[model samples]
Target chain A: MIESVHEVLTRSALVSVAATLVAAVIGIGLGTALALARIPGKQLMTAVVNTGMAVPTVVIGLAVALLLWRSGPLGHLDLMYTVHGMVLAQVLIATPLITGITLAAMRLLPSALPDQLRALGANRAQLVLRMWIEARIPLLAAAMAGFGKAISEVGAVTIVGGNIHGHTQVMTTAIVERVGRGDFNSALLYGAVLLALAFAVNGLLASVRHRGASWERN
Target chain B: MGAELSLRQVRQVRAGREVLRIDALDIGPGEHMSVLGPNGAGKTTLLRLLVGVDRPTSGTVTLDGVSTARRGVEVRRRVAYATQQPGLLSTSVRRNVELPLRWRKVPRRERARLVAEALDRLRVAHLADRPAQTLSGGEQQRVNLARALAIDPEVLLLDEPAAGLDAQTRSAFFADLEQALADRATTVVQVSHRAEEALRFADRVVVLVEGSVHQVGAPEALHHRPADASVAALVGYDNLVSATVRTDGEVLVGGAPTGLLHRGPAGAATVAVFAGGVLLADAHGPGLPVRVARVIPGPGHHVLALEGAVSLLAHLPMRVQAPLTGDVVRVVFDPVLSVVLPDSPADPTPGVLDGVELAYPSRVPS
Candidate 1:
């Protein structure tokens, strides 16, 4: 039972971390572009992103499930009921949240900072990079938020990964499966492990944020 | 080498309202030009265009004949701008000063030298290790200027660098700033609304009003011979009173001779009177009779607010007896301290005062 719990915890950590990393890359990039560029339909895009942030995990799971089903358009990839499919579903659920936070973080910086950076001879890339570093605390919070949403969500992984033991089951799906089988003790153990895993990851990230914040002050 | 900046037919429109329009302006290499204007006069808009942070709605702002809007980072690398706000990054003052050098790809050793030199020049070297965000406004501004100067930019643009500081701090900031740039031949352009700030340390001053360049000349030229009544008010001619210039060239205020003359075909004119030139005497002389309304003490003088057919202000030396409020006195305008500008119908008489009752008898000078 402990071995099974370890396997499920490891899978959960791997899949969630993978999804968070992918979501962060896409979210930060998109958010920065939206924040700085003078593109049209920006208001509409922001509205869509805001709606996506508040949309339910179950709704996103349903969408990903429909797209990756055997008869669906992406069926040729054969990702349905796989760990990759689970990661994809979690990414969908977390990307919008990370993106929204990032957009707000970038906007909170001094409006003239980008121009000041340009005036200081920073090229386009340097401007964005420096601004990100300036707002790194909020950005790190965005990443943590994304990871929290990714690892803790149960509906998306349940629907898309299908909880196949020794194959696609994560801690969330494992707890759900144990409870279904009336194995109350095993369910409580998986739940305890999930809570510990979240606390450990967030604690590590918070320390890194603290160091980044105090790097120059000291 | 310093870069020559020019604006040709430049116009800036924001929210469909024209904010700045300049037909032609040129700052020569190594020249220290100051753009002087009142608040909302688009001085900052002009600086933003020159710094390439903003593009003009029409025409061009060019550095060495290269349009700033189209110029690449190579061109931008030669210019630096110190904004009105001390926009410091959340870092050490040393890093804030060093980042520009880093951006310009200065060698590590050279970057260190420039950073230290700039910090020392701005008198902020002692604050190097301090977090920039924790400094006071004046110190942060010094750091901001230090960062801009660290790159040894050929063209430095300062937008009211000492704007919000107190009088003493502003004076010290400018003194340090002047000492810092005394040896460098950078083409610098500073913008400020205060007359003293615009005139100080500037080889040439541009008088901007309502998005238009009213006058551009040497600081002394703008101070002594402002082109219009509005320009006069901007350049520290505190009292703008309605006057008439006779065909014989004698200037008259309130149907009385003012002992000043102008070489213009003038029927009506506005007399720009310096506050120090409005001499006061007991109401027995051949001058305009006025009632003292307020006698405000100053550092070494007394400012008397006087009411007559027109409101006027007179600066008297502290040794002289200043009249109390409601004391009638005769005020005379010294010709050397006054200029007769052609009638600017749009400007109200006495540019700085309001609410004082002015009831002149219908007495026309013959």
Candidate 2:
């Protein structure tokens, strides 16, 4: 029992950590691009991103499953019912949340920054890098929000991972399985561990974001 | 070295409206030029075009006679534009000043030297290690100016660089800024709606109204011989009264002849007078009848409003006991100082008074 629970905890951490890393990278990049690019259909893209933020995670899971199912266009990859499939589904569920927060943070910046940087002779790459640096603290906050969504998400991961014992079982799926049987205590332990992990990650992020960010210390 | 900047028949259109139309404008090599105008008068737009950030809707803008249309981003390297808001990074002041140097990929040693010089020049060297976000608005603006100068730009455009500073701070900043650029061979194009700053700092001034150049000349010419009511108000004319030019070429106020003479064809003309041009006249003497309605005190002067056919605001040199309120006194303008221009047709759009009220009060803290 202890060994299985340990596997569940490790698998859950792996899935959330991998998904958060991938989503954060893509989301921050895409969000910054959206904020800075003045191309056509920018408003339309922003509207679509906002709508994507409201998409249900289960719907994402179903969509991904369909795409990766046998005879589906992406079926050649055979990501279904595998850990890779869970990561893919989790990424889809978390990217929008991460992206929405990052976009909002970048948008809140004073509009003159990009222009001023250009005046100072910054090339395109320099402008983007400077903007990212100025938005560092808030982007970290975006990461925290993304992690929260990725770790707590159940619908997408369960639908894709299949909750198979000793294989795809993560903490949340194990807890669900335990509840379906007569193992409430085990279910409670998994719940407690998930909560603790979330607190740990968020606390670390908060310290970096807010501590000594006062005027004097920058 | 210094670059000559000019606009040849340039026009800017926005939302299908021609917002700026300039036939010809020249900023001589190493000259300081200021453009004064009301809000939404396209002052910022003109600067943007000069810096080559935006192409003109028509015609050409040139730097040193080379057209800016095809200069590309490379043109931006030779010029620096700073807006009213001192947009500084959230990093150290030294870093903010080091930005231009960094973008040019200057060697680390040279970058440090240039950054230090810029900081010292702007008089913000003491705050070099402090976070730029922590500095006061004036300090941040100084750093912004320092960053602009770090590139040794040939043409510099500043939009209200000294804006939001107190009188003392503004003067001090300008003194430092001018000294910094005095030997740099840089041609500066600045936009300042403040009459005194433009008059004091710029060798040439352009007054813009409704996206068209109203008048361009020495600051004194714009101040003393404004082209019309709009230009008059922009040049700090406290009183603009429309009057008829009599057959004898004498302008009349309140249907009676005043001593002010005009050289234009006899018809309608608008009289423009500054506060210092108003002189106290004998009640029964050659001036018009007026009652002092209020006296507002300034640092070295007093503003007195007179009620006549139209209310007039005038600046009087500081006196121990100027005329009191409710005193009916005859006041006459210094004919040599006043201006008479052909009365322009009443504008279909909003008047310049509304523009003045809209621009100043919101910016200046009462």
Candidate 3:
């Protein structure tokens, strides 16, 4: 039971790390673009992103599964039930969360930053980069919260990732499978590990928030 | 090199309201021009238009004959604008000062030197490593000024740079600014509510009233001969009285007549006299009957409120022995220093003290 728990925990951690890295890259890029773009229908776009944040992981998983199945348009790529499919599902869920939070954070930034940058002769690209830097810590906090939410989610990946041994099985799905099979010991161990990961992410967030708050107070 | 800035009939309409309207304004090379106006007088809007941050609805703003709209990017590189509230990054003061140079892609060595020089000039070198948010209001303002000066732009637009500064700090800041402008041939255009500062620092002063250029001239001229009552109020004329223009060319204030020359209308007029222009007398002098109302002490002078048939204020040297409040006294006016306005026909009996006009013309050399 102990060895099985260790194996499941290891695989879940690996998948979680991969998903978070992919999500961060895609989420931050798209989030920044959405936040800064001054296009028509921007409010609608923001509404869509906000709606995406409230979507259940299970719904996203089912939607992705339908799109990647043999009968679907992109079935030719044969990505169904693969680890990459699960990664895509997690990225989809995390992207909007990061984007929404980032947009909100940018909005909260003092209105003076952009004007000051422009007055200093900074072009659009330079202004965007400077504003991002000015808003870095908050952005990081938003991204991390999205990463935490993505890693801890189970319903979406379990349905689409098809928990295969030594392949698609991740910690959350494996723990559920273990519990269903009456392997209480292994399930308990996996649960503990998952809890630890969540704790660490939260701890990091708190520390960052404390530093940012003090910086603001000063 | 210094560049001349000119605005030709610039007008801005935002949200269906005219935010700024300026006729022809010509700022010479290396000249320091001060913009004086009350809040909401479109001073900031005008500055933004000049710096190309906001496009004018009509007309044009040019730097050295180059149209601002046609060369906004190039023009921005030559103009630096500092807002009233200095906008600093969430980073250290050093980083804030280094931003403009970094945007221009200055070499690391040059950027470092420039940042150091700017910090030193603002007397905030010790705060280089501290986060900008840690500074006091005055410190933050100086940092903002330093950041704007980092690029050494040819034209600097400052919006109330000394608003939150102490007297000593403000003097020091202005002294450093003067030195920097003299050395670099930079043209400064500052917006200020402090009339005295405007008069002392600016070669040319422009007054704005309700989105229009009310007056423009040398600081002294604006002070002495305000274009209207509004201009007189702006330049700190404290004695504004509602008087009737009598037929004999003298103005009657509260039934007592003073030898103030008037023409045109006999209905009503506004008599504006600078506090410095009113002279205090023990008894009835050549002016009019007055009673001492209040004696308020000020920085360099004492403000005496004399209650005659018309109330007036006299600003005299602080060392002079002055009558206390309620003391009977008389006052005299210098006709050369007084401005008489014909009553607006629309409101013939304009209430004695309803609206005070504080917008005035700029002071110009006589």
Candidate 4:
């Protein structure tokens, strides 16, 4: 029982971290582009991103499962009921949330900041990089928000990963399996572990935020 | 090491409306020039053009004969702009002053030296390690100026550096600013709405009105010999009484002799009277009679608002007994404190008793 709990916790951590990293890379880049570039259809694209953030995790899971099911469009890859499919589903769920937060963060900066940077001899690339550095506190918060959302979700991982013992079980699906077998003690144990995992991640993120904010001290 | 900035036929149009139009203007190397204008006169737009942040709608703002808009980063590296707002980064004062030097790829050792020198110049060196966002308003402004001066650019653009400070702080801010630029051979252009602030240390002053250059001359020229009635009001002249120039060069106000003479064309003209020049006279004296409406006391003088043939304001010395409200007294104009200018079509002398148009050109062709 102890070994099974440890395996589930490690797999959950790996899947969520991998998904968050991929989503953050795509989302932060796209969000910054949307915020600064003068492109057509910007309003429409922002609306689509905002709507994506509100989508249900179960709905994304169903879509990903369908894409990976036998004889489906992407069936040949045979990724159904696997860790890869679970990570893909979580990525879809977290990307929009990160993107929306990043876009809002960039817009909240002082409007004259870009011009001030340019006048100080910063070129295009330097301007964006400096703006990102200036807004690090909020951008760090966006990443944390994305990671939290990706880890706590269960309905999508269950539908896609199948909770197969020893292979594709994460903490969320393991808690469901333990409860179904009338194993209340094991279910409660998994629940406590999941809560500790969230607290640990949040603690780490808070430390990073505090370090970034230290420069603001009087 | 300073760069000469010249604007020839520069016109900036925003939202399909012309905001700034300068036919031709030049600032010599190492010279300090001030652009004085009221709000919405496009002073900021002109500054942005000169800084190469935004290209003018037409014509060119050239630095040392090179187009600011067309030339790329190399040209911009030689110029620095300090905006009205502090706009400090959320970092230490030392970093805020050091980043520009770093962007210019200055060596780390040299960057530290320049940053220290700039902070010392603005007298904010003690706040170097403090977070820039935590400083007081005055401190923030000093840091902003220090950041701009740290780059050691050839041309510096200051857009109302002391804009939102109180009277005392504004004075002190300008003093520090002047000290910072004292020995640097950098061409500087500052814009402001206050006459005292704008003319304090400028080698030449540009009076911009309604997006046009009304006059560009020495600070004394703007004070004593304004181009027109509007320019007079901008430069601290409080009374713009309409008058006429006789064929013999005598001045008449309200169809009575003013005992002042002007060499302008003998027709409609305005007597731009500095309040210091409006003197009190006896009821039987040779001047226009007016009833004192109000008297406001100041440190060393009293300001009297008088009503009669023309609404007028006068600043009288404290030694002279001030006229009480409702007292009807005659007033005379001191020729040394007033001058006759070509009547302004834009701000027509409101109560002019005469109207015969004459073509009298201004000192600076408008």
Instruction: Supply DockQ values for each candidate.
Output: 0.78, 0.42, 0.53, 0.70
In candidate 1, position B24 carries an lDDT of 98
Across B207-262, the per-residue lDDT of candidate 4 in tens digits comes to 88889998899998888677777788888888888888788877788876665666
**TM-scores for all predictions:** 0.95, 0.90, 0.88, 0.91
Model 2 over residues B1-366: C-alpha lDDT tens digits? 878988989999999999999999988989988999888999999988887767999999998888765684677788988888988888789888887777787899999998898888998999999988889989988998998898788989999899999999999988998899888778888898888877777889998888999888898777656777888888887788877777766677787544566656677777777776666654565666778999989778888999987678777767535789999876666664577776644321111110112111222122
Q: Could you tell me how far off, in angstroms, the CA of residue A63 lies in candidate 3 after the best superposition?
A: 1.8
**CA lDDT, every model vs. true structure:** 0.87, 0.80, 0.78, 0.86
Worst 10 residues of 2 chain A by lDDT: A209-218
**Model 1 over residues B273-364: C-alpha lDDT tens digits?**
98877876335545678889999998898999989889998888787777789888777666567777777443222222111121211111
Candidate 2, residue B269: Cα displacement in angstroms equals 0.5
Judge candidate 3 at residue A51 and give its lDDT.
95
Q: What is the TM-score of chain B in candidate 4?
A: 0.92
lDDT tens digits, residues A1-218, model 4?
88988999999999999999999998888788899888999899899899999999999999999999997898898899999999999999999999999899999999899889888889889999998888888888889999999999998999999989988999988988889999999999999999999999999999989988885552
Task: Point out the higher-scoring one by lDDT: 1 or 3.
Answer: 1
TM-score result, candidate 4: 0.91
TM-score quality measure for candidate 2: 0.90
Ranking, DockQ, top scorer first: 1, 4, 3, 2
Which residue ranges in model 2 land beyond 4 Å of their true spot? A1-3, A210-218, B65-72, B295-302, B316-321, B344-366
